[model samples]
Target: MTTALFPPAPVSTWLVPLDDTADGVVASLGLARPEGAPASWLDADERARAARLHDATDRHRWLVSHVALRLLLGAALEVHPSAVSVVREACPRCGGPHGRPALGPSAGRPLRFSLSRSGGHALIALRRGLDVGVDLETATAGTPSPAAPATDGLARWVRTEALLKSTGEGLTRDPDAVALRPTAPGVWSEHVEGDDAAGPELVGPAPTVADLALPSPLVAAVAGPGLDRARVRVHLPATAAA
Candidate 1:
């Protein structure tokens, strides 16, 4: 088992790369195929949505990668694979609502998780007693270049947007409704409220955003309580099982 160097109480984040190798693809696919698994394992709406993307290549890859991440994280927590289940929910990627995949009744433990992938890498975040969200982008010629500097304003905007997405709020509603405040180095706060309606007031403290050191063009962000210690673990397909 890969030992977590940090204290046990802190959040653990793992970033696994999906290489083009056969093993990498296989690992990812195992999670995508429902196979003999119970249909009830997924949420009703999520099952319907996944059915539509069953034949889509990009969607397949994304689902597989996400499943693999969930399995790995569950294992890390010493939870049995069969006891870990994901609810299929409509998680929009770009400007819509802020939502993260939910866990089934079997996953009622305090651990929370989120998944995101871009280019060829899949990122997973796992934390105890905190609502966590993670996003990763792999560097590729077709992807945004990391060498380009990130403007302070742009970084703030992207971080807040990502945080909102994690919270299940619709991103298309109003960008001006949320405010991001810099609290410390690489740390931010998200101040959210209802827009013109009696919407819920949200005040998330100490959200953290960091630039990952992946060889590819990638940006990873996380928003949650007690996320100051969020750290990334990189795993290649060959070494992941070990």
Candidate 2:
């Protein structure tokens, strides 16, 4: 058997491309389609919301995110994927259930995770005892051209989004208000939290932020505790059974 790239304890990140054909072959991941997986796996409101997405790609991305999350959590918790519970907690500022998703009360562990997708890519970051957030963006013609004077702008955007996501506020918080400057090679530390902002932080210590290198035109970053010890593993569709 191929060596399994299991999620490490306490903290780690997984970068996966949503290229797996959704051909009803998630059995190796211990997932059950059972007709209403999306409607049932997602919270009621989210299910209805997902239904309103007119584009098939949008709908498919939603399904992959939720299903992948449950499967990962199930592997970590040693339970069947279908047995895992996910909750979209209320917005910290609005008290509405449209904020970041979290593991439900029955999960029995403080499994914090963040999900982000852009273009054809997706990223999932998880940590056991601290909050975590990840953002992925595929560079396109609209992004600052590599030769543009301010070429680092896209990286800054991902850093800000990752920081906001770590706080569970996500893009709901003004991206302009959060500032991240390069601290070192591959690392960008939070430099400012503008007005209408709280301090930049996660569940515990200041989160370590760093860019992730991928094989595509994607730029990814993650923010969370214990990240200095974190490892990123790429799991392709064929490796699910490993």
Candidate 3:
């Protein structure tokens, strides 16, 4: 994509492979922790939440996602990983604390991002000012979880999820109502309101949506205003320590 045809901000996309061994995850992430305690990279609330997850794999995945997020933001801000502050705004619909996550003032600018993980892979997307959402999933042979839409429905499903997540409504909105039509390579036209519903459902403004060119077994998508124009740089071999 040329810069003239579509003016875009610099965006970075990172993929991280989840470690199968839970014990070495902290060290692999280059994070420190007190003896017999959770990783120091996580805040008190995060630690408490992690402690609540009885499943080791689930806990490890959560730790890796948040830790990776902190490291990524810190690298961009040139600060200690733990120093990067993040918060979850209250839901616009119900005034709850489960809304989309946001960076603190320390992040500077309108740094927006979205994080998603499926099976063994984790994805983090970053964009400035423009809101962005990303989803990563694997369609390998296995029982599909309720959280994951079926593999047969990935194209539409992933794009819809990316759009909903971009607006912070998430799965709260009926998935059947969201739809998109491909306009070109890496470009999709979003129908915020579609034939699935009869009312005037507000989905905010549409964003530039596209399917990511990822390796096999993994399907992903990104959505944001002008994102189709944004330069997307994908870094692979997600096993790096940084």
Candidate 4:
């Protein structure tokens, strides 16, 4: 991919071995208001969303989140930020408009991507010919319960979130309803479970899940069909990396 980016900043793309099928890349960026993003870059809807965030800090973070997202997407597609068109796919389970956001009518082969943000950072993931999902959660300051402290339970929760996003289920399925267990290093096995007359939790279709190597106070995971063996290239912006 070409490095034609806005603000003329250097971005790093780091590669690691993990793929059995779909090739992937993930870009990490700081959400603390980046340079070169004009208020005019946002449309009415985004502006409305930003307006809802009355706090100036929150508003700037939201704006920069979008700026980073557009920049990352633009780089992946090799187009101007304005040229990247995104459309929502129908929900796989409910057949509704509330589903994964994907690149629409763009150049080259259709690439699957996922975006996740937490605290002061964000992640954008792109994969070739495979559905992918990612989730990032900031650790709790004092006693982070489900998603903080980087405990086993927190890891389970993030995995559930990533899997749900991958399947376009979102919160429609309760996080507590999924059962997860570690099956390998930096990986977990999960299945949708429910009570039936036959048993307490019935095992169902499960997705490939793995933990991300982010720092403390920030836990993350990604899911897909073949992520158990995926080559996820994690990219850091050159400025932030230094």
Candidate-wise lDDT, in order: 0.53, 0.66, 0.70, 0.60
| Regions of candidate 1 where Cα sits further than 4 Å from its true position | 2-9, 19-51, 54-56, 77-82, 88-99, 138-157, 170-173, 191-199, 202-213, 229-242
The model with the greatest lDDT is 3
Candidate 4 local lDDT, 26-128, one digit each (tens): 2333222223434554456667888899887667666666655565666666666656677788875678876778777655655777777666666656666
Q: Tell me which of candidates 1 and 2 scores higher on TM-score.
A: 2
Give the range where candidate 1 is weakest over 10 consecutive residues by summed lDDT: 29-38
Could you tell me which 10 consecutive residues in candidate 4 have the lowest summed lDDT?
A: 16-25
TM-scores of the candidates are: 0.63, 0.77, 0.80, 0.72
RMSD of 2: 4.6
lDDT of 2 by residue, 133-207 (tens): 888877765557342235467777777788778877776777776667676777776665564465533455676
Model 4 Cα RMSD, 1 decimal: 8.4
Error of 2 at 83 (Å): 1.6
Mind giving the per-residue lDDT tens digits that candidate 1 earns over 83-142? 567654454455333345666666757667777766556766666666666655443443
Report backbone clashes per prediction. Answer: 8, 0, 0, 7
Clashing pairs in 2: none
What is the C-alpha local distance difference test score of candidate 4? Answer: 0.60
